[model samples]
Target: MTGNTHIVGGIAASLAFAQISNDNPVLLVGAGVIGALIPDICHGGSIIGRKFSIVSKVVTGVFGHRSFTHSLVFLFLIGALLHTLLTNDSIIAGILVGMVSHFILDMATKNGIKLLFPLKITVRFPITTRTGGAVENLVFAALSLLSVYFGYEAFAGYF
Candidate 1:
């Protein structure tokens, strides 16, 4: 999926989690938004990649696109690292959840994802959606709406 899709999905996932957890919704959503874009750092042309070119180049050179960086191990490692650095459990959990959502969305695409990197196992969900296609865009849009609604509910104490 594209960056926008990942972002919307991440925001939606974070919002949903926030509604359930009743923790700091802002922090969770922030971490989730960032986490969503974190996986695409392998592509130099991506928004996050272009913003952090050096990091993107290093990560792309080391793992390439949709390899180790896209794996669950990488997500866990990142979550742990962030937890250590930020010392915030909620943020760390949000990041992991957002990254997992991204990984799952990618798994539904035609290209799929190397979920078990180094093991050389490519997992596809059989749904077979095209990356950045109209359907994906629509899904993102709907997720965006859901995110907005959930965010408002969380902020307004409607839950």
Candidate 2:
């Protein structure tokens, strides 16, 4: 999946979290965006990767794309680290959910993802689409719509 799709997924996930947890949407959405982009740090062409080229090179050199960073082990480790560093439940949830959304989107791709790292296992939906293909564009459109829906549901009270 593309970065725009990940971003939309993050926004949708964060907005959904806000509606469920009744927390600050701004912080959650911020963290969510970070989380969504963080997993793609292995790809130098990724949204966050371009900004952190050194880290991207190191991570890609060590683990390769869609291997360790896309794994559930990394997700849990990040969750733990974030929990230890930050006490806000909503923010943590936002980040984790965003990351999960990344996993979900990647899993839908033809290349799939190594959801379970250190195990050399790949997990994906039975029906997967090529990255940036028509199916992916459709997925992106759907996520965009979901983001709008979740945004309205979460922020309607403020409006």
Candidate 3:
């Protein structure tokens, strides 16, 4: 999936999680965007990758795309780091949820993801779509609608 898809997916996931965490919506959504782009750090051309080129280069050099960064290992490691650094558990939850959304979105692609990495196995759903293809666009649309719905739900009583 492209960056936009990840962003929308992240937003949707974050909003859903917000219902439980009750964190600041803005903070969670912003963290969601960061989380969405983070997994793509293995690709120097990706949004987060371009921003942090040195780390991107190193991670890509060692793990390549869709390997370590997309794995549960990276998730927990990042999760641990975020837990230690960020005082807000809700923000950490939003970020992790967004990252999980990224994994799920990529899992929809033809190449899939190495969720349980260092094991050399690829995991994907039964059906897959081409990245940036029509199906992916439809998925993007669906996620957009979901984001809207979740967003409304999150802010319903407040507004």
Candidate 4:
């Protein structure tokens, strides 16, 4: 999926977390946004990649695009690392959830992803739509609308 789609998914996931946890909404939202963009570090052309081109290039060289960094193993490892390093449980959970959301969204695209990695397994949805195609765009739009609604609800303390 495109960066915008990731952002939308991130926001939606964060809002869901907020509803469930009822903690500080802003911080969870921020973590979710970061988590959404974190997986694309291997692409070298994504929004996060452009901002940190050198790092992205190095990672891409080592893992290649949509490989280890985009896999479930990587997500678990990163989540474990973050949990060990960060003191807050909410933040760690938010990041992990956001990353999961990103991975799931990417899997929905036509190209799919090596979600298992190292094992050479690729999972995709039956829809067969391109990453940034009309279907993805529509999904992004729906996510955006949901995000807005949730954001408002969060701010208003309506969950």
The most accurate candidate by TM-score is 3
By lDDT, the better pick of 2 and 3 is 3
Candidate 3's residue-wise lDDT over 107-128, tens digit each? 9999999999998999998999
Compared with the true structure, all predictions reach lDDT values of 0.86, 0.90, 0.92, 0.85
* Model 4 agreement with the true structure over 12-58: per-residue lDDT tens digits: 98987787785677888888889999999998889899999999999
How far off is residue 89 in model 2, in Å? Answer: 2.7
TM-scores of the models, in the order given: 0.91, 0.95, 0.96, 0.92
Q: Highest lDDT among the candidates is held by which one?
A: 3
Best-first order by lDDT: 3, 2, 1, 4
lDDT of 2 by residue, 1-159 (tens): 999999988988888888778678888888899899999999999999999999999999999999999998999999999989998877888899899989999999888999988888888999999888998888888888988888888778878
- Which residue pairs in candidate 1 collide? none
Q: By TM-score, highest first, what's the ranking?
A: 3, 2, 4, 1
- State the lDDT at 103 in candidate 3: 97
Predicted structure 2: lDDT: 0.90
Misplaced by over 4 Å in model 3 are none
